[model samples]
Target: MEQVAEKLGRPDAGDAAMGKAWGIWYGSDSTAKRRDEIAIYSSYRDTSMRVKDVKQIRITSNAFKTQDGLATGANLEDTKLKFPDIKKLSSYLNEKKDTVVVYDAKKEGIGFEFLKGKSISLTVHPVNTAVNDTYLTLHPEWKLIN
Candidate 1:
């Protein structure tokens, strides 16, 4: 921590703040290191998500599919924030029979479209962009099959 604070260069000279300065420095370094580590690991995992190996999942509206007679939503929320698995698909369409594929990498941080009607689609997370490649499909399923 002291190393971090010293690098920050506190304005208050001769004020016994070396330890605090190092703390700031180490904090910044810790965050940076963690971010880098995540990026590296993500890259390593993405290599296996090939174009021919994506498990396809069809998207449906709020009232389309039923899992044990329950509703499931997979609505399109935004496009800018998507990290479509490029290796898995090309693009999402509104047409029927459109097949979409998503990687397990994005199983979290994704939201649903419960009780609403709008555009729905699926894409790989940003961390899996290379794996998804140009393949981010939009398939709508009218019914849920076991």
Candidate 2:
């Protein structure tokens, strides 16, 4: 945790229980109000940390890109062009009242949460359990795009 904090310059906030996640903010204030430009989360098995997944939000710079060169701020068409195999799983209004589309690359263990016309966030996880088990088990209606 200290190493990550050092590299990311101290997380503005964190949730030790929620998959041991940390929110890294950009710009001044360093609070939730400033917006968590980046979110880092780790999965655990038994007492061991299994894997880490990093998510970025509203990132306009070209510093980060997917394996197919898709980046935040890109439109749905651009995502489809980059990841031809991408599959749309569902769509709903997010807490922000924005229409969010969820896309998944089941084989690649990657998922994207796009807000309306532009890509907003990207999440990568293990294929065996791309999403939280509790949520999946509880809401069987929510299916992954296979």
Candidate 3:
């Protein structure tokens, strides 16, 4: 994709909606372990319209391979997964630097994530699914948009 997110990645900690589409972060590179998928409903991307396929979420990173972010010579410290904070998230979003969407965070779903450098567009239910219920981390910096 031409639009690559800059500040997003596997967060060490925090918190998506469904049918609508929201951003998500993960600590592990792959969704191998207890993968948690969240359904995105409404977001800055698709507005109030609810999408049909809530299972189309995608996750990736530049540090991985010939894809998103991992700049040349970037070490673990640079791409380390840290807990997310609402404030930090707002700051990142405010800067318009790290734009990403994590479509899944539910306890037993396939666990879909858009990573840091990419924006995920999916469908979600705004009334049923809550934003705070699925936070990226408990950290103060990982902010969630309501």
Top lDDT prediction, candidate number: 2
Report lDDT (Cα) of residue 104, candidate 2.
67
Report, for every candidate in turn, its global Cα lDDT versus the true structure.
0.27, 0.55, 0.31
- Best candidate (score: TM-score): 2
Per-model root-mean-square deviation over C-alphas: 19.7, 6.1, 14.6
Q: Provide the clash count, candidate 3.
A: 56
* lDDT against true structure, model 1: 0.27
9-108: candidate 3 lDDT, tens digit per residue: 4333223433333444553536444333322222333554533333223233323331334332233233232211211123223234344333332322
- The alpha-carbon deviation from the true structure for residue 11 of candidate 3, after best TM-score superposition, in angstroms, is 15
**Would you list the rank order by lDDT, best first?**
2, 3, 1
> Which candidate, 1 or 2, has the higher TM-score?
2
Ranking by TM-score: 2, 3, 1
Error of 1 at 84 (Å): 15
Worst 10 residues of 1 by lDDT: 35-44
lDDT (Cα, tens digit) per residue for candidate 2, span 1-146: 44556787876654555564445445453553324255555434435555543432223233568776777778878877766677887776544555667776656666677766877666665664443321222113433333
Reference-based lDDT, residue 108, model 2: 64
- Could you tell me the lDDT of residue 63 within candidate 2? 53
